[model samples]
Target: MEQTHSRVAVVTGGSGGIGRAVAERLGADGMNVVVAYSGNTERAAEVVKAVEAAGGRAVAGRADVAEPDEVDALFDTAEREFGGVDVVVNTAGIMILKPLVEFDLDDLDRMHRTNIRGTFVVSRAAARRLRSGGALINFSTSVTRLALPTYSAYAASKGAVDALTLVLARELRGRDITVNAVAPGPTATPLFLDGKPQEVVERMAGQAPLERLGTPDDIATAVAFLAGPARWVNGQVVYVNGGIA
Candidate 1:
């Protein structure tokens, strides 16, 4: 993905599809990784093993990224276990699809709690803790641009991430850290495929110029670039979709 070195990364939602791929990618790139999750420690442990199998160091932890204290402890674990943190990838999120008019306020709240508030918590910690030459990779979605139906609430939450990530990059000023968001489109992940009909999924995939849904590894490649050599690309949302526009 990029050049390798002695680096430490804290990847939230590491138990999930894209997060797991990103963690493994970073680990293979020669970084120690802290695979953080909100629940399902078993899946998180599996990620830790993947990282180690890639010839890098890794640990797993539980942190509800929306909570400040849990997030604080996550970064603390990174430092205590790996010496320092150079990369922070906030991938923990939840998605519930419904027309905005019929959308359950409760579902919206739950999604925002993780997608927006959770992002702020991790960004806040990364701002204070990430070592120089660090990178903060936050996840957004192409739906914000695609304006797909039933994605309004989810898009709004990720819109906040786009705004927050950009502003945080500037706030870092001389910190030598790059803050950016990765906006993946129609990715092949449990989060995206769970409730979709096969025909519907195929239609979505066909719309992309590449004629296939983006794989987790495709998005992970983008994150790896941001985490390493793409130092000049800050305060931006890098879309990893296959020409989805």
Candidate 2:
């Protein structure tokens, strides 16, 4: 039934900063979008409206990325409404910074549940369900490379994501789906800025050669590229961190 038409996308965390931006970006690119938010239906509704205003068809669905049944239902909704799924952008995540020695095990569990476990669940769904020529774009962080203090747990969780992404790319060989992860450094998202102080923010901003924080839209552009045009660029983690290692 998906004949000679625009591709569809499912954007998890569509209510958050980076997720919201990517949804709008893909909408502008003329893809029918399904915005999946774990909570906050109001923010999700706003995203749906913005996507529509951008000239792309969109709807909102509620699903926790870590929950397979919920994500399956989300994909079902996308197909039922937007035709068929072609791109899946998994951006839902959580971060709790602390020294590794003193970090609470519970926090590690929570972060892993959201970041590592969530990626696996959603990527699995995408793998089994996406139409040919589809894409799976997962999120990672430059902290895995930076190895900064208080980021050990976060980095560890994302390291697992990187591993899974690499293997999944090969596992989906011959399927025509490009699986890749985008590792962003010090992005200007509310999730990143929520607890950091001004001095810390400025220091991080200075670390980038661009002398500024990367915006959600910057990351979104990377997602859009991987989602649509970067056909041969698969099984890799594209760092969109302004030349930051």
Error in Å for residue 9 of model 2? 0.4
lDDT of 1 by residue, 61-149 (tens): 99999989999998889989988889999999999999999999999999999999999999999999998899999999999999999
Which lDDT tens digits does candidate 2 get at residues 1-245? 23387989999999999999999999999999999999899999999999999889999999989999999999999989977899999999999999989999999999999999999999999999999999999999999989999999999999999999999999998899999999999999998998999999999999999999999999999999999889899999999999888
Best by TM-score: 2
TM-score (all chains, Cα) for each model: 0.97, 0.98
Model 1 residue pairs with clashes: none
Clashes of each: 0, 0
lDDT agreement with native, every candidate = 0.94, 0.95
RMSD (Cα, Å) of model 1: 2.0
Task: lDDT for model 1, please.
Answer: 0.94
